[model samples]
Target: MIKKLLELSNLETTISLRQKELLELEEKIEEKKRLLKQLSRKVRKYEEYNVAEKEAAVTVAVEAEPDSEKKVGEIARTDLVRLLESGRVPQSVIESLKDKRYSKDTFDLNFPMLREVTDMGKVDELKKDQ
Candidate 1:
């Protein structure tokens, strides 16, 4: 009887461990899905910008609605966040921006399309994810 009880307890423990691992795997899967969606959106934005490479030169055109009041040449902050998360921008560039002392000219020079970022909260979230 004691041996049977011990075996049952062992089985219960195994079940619990497996459940925990399953939950972890689910979370990882969800994260991957989110990343995939973000990448898809980035690709679409690139298409809208009309970025194309021809004859070893790149051309970019930003199209906006006639009634839109957005600045003539500026990329959205969320787009920048996605770009940073996508690993297209080198880790060194992100590291350099970590310091708040960087001048606007330097920032503009590095990220020409990004005129300004109002919601730094997303950047913080991106750092936390990394």
Candidate 2:
């Protein structure tokens, strides 16, 4: 009977050890789940922050320029004739000024005398008058 009691006690000790191991494993699993949840929350927050920053930058760029105007080219024959008849500019210069594709810099670079005849404001004034 004493031998039987000793055997039963050994069996109980083995079962107690197994139960402790199982409890430790369960605790480790719970800790991993908590850490995974925290990491997922951090990732989602960063994604939302990145999207908001990009949207704000785009909005700022669009709103920065409200009244910016583009410069358009204009050349009128009537203005060219008036400039020519005024005796301030030559006939050849007047003929060359008929084309609207040429800017003041381009015309002056091609024919220096054209620059002396019509002031830079002449083309702009003629466009406004028309």
Candidate 3:
């Protein structure tokens, strides 16, 4: 019957649309998982350099590897990035850097900053689930 054929056509079309949507949702879930992993790594890095408040006034010993060549009195920008991300750096310290705020006395070191750059141009279409 023509009525029966129409019903079959409509049902197939609806199923195809839903299948496409399911694929898109799956892709988003995967993307979110990747982002979570990146954030967790950042958090772990933050925790590594984090200091407890009670230990604030305490002086800690510094031990550099005999073969290491890192400077004793300087941190690179990436190191600065860690400090900034740690959230424990006093606002005063951040403020004091003002003159060095992109200001001179500002010895340039590569600091890590928390920034996520999403390029929208590379988005891909999710293929429909079979």
TM-score of each: 0.39, 0.47, 0.42
* Model 2 misplaced regions, further than 4 Å: 1-4, 71-130
Q: Point out the worst 10-residue segment of candidate 3 by lDDT.
A: 57-66
Better of 1 and 3 by TM-score: 3
Note each model's CA RMSD in angstroms: 16.0, 21.8, 19.3
Scored by lDDT, model 2 comes in at: 0.56
Ten consecutive residues with minimal summed lDDT in candidate 1? 55-64
Q: State the lDDT of candidate 1 residue by residue for 1-130, as single tens digits.
A: 9999999999999999999999999999999999999999999987655433221121111221334455533444444555556665544345545544442344433333322347776765543312
Residue-level lDDT of model 2, residues 7-122, one tens digit each, is 99999999999999999999999999999999999999987876666555435433444343522122223433344456754343444445444434544333222333266657
Error of 1 at 91 (Å): 28
**lDDT, candidate 3, residue 35?**
100
Worst 10 residues of 2 by lDDT: 70-79
CA lDDT for candidate 3:
0.52
lDDT of 3 by residue, 39-125 (tens): 999998776545342134112111213245656344434445555667765553445444333323333423311222266453332
lDDT of 1 at 99: 41
What lDDT score belongs to each candidate, Candidate 1 first?
0.54, 0.56, 0.52
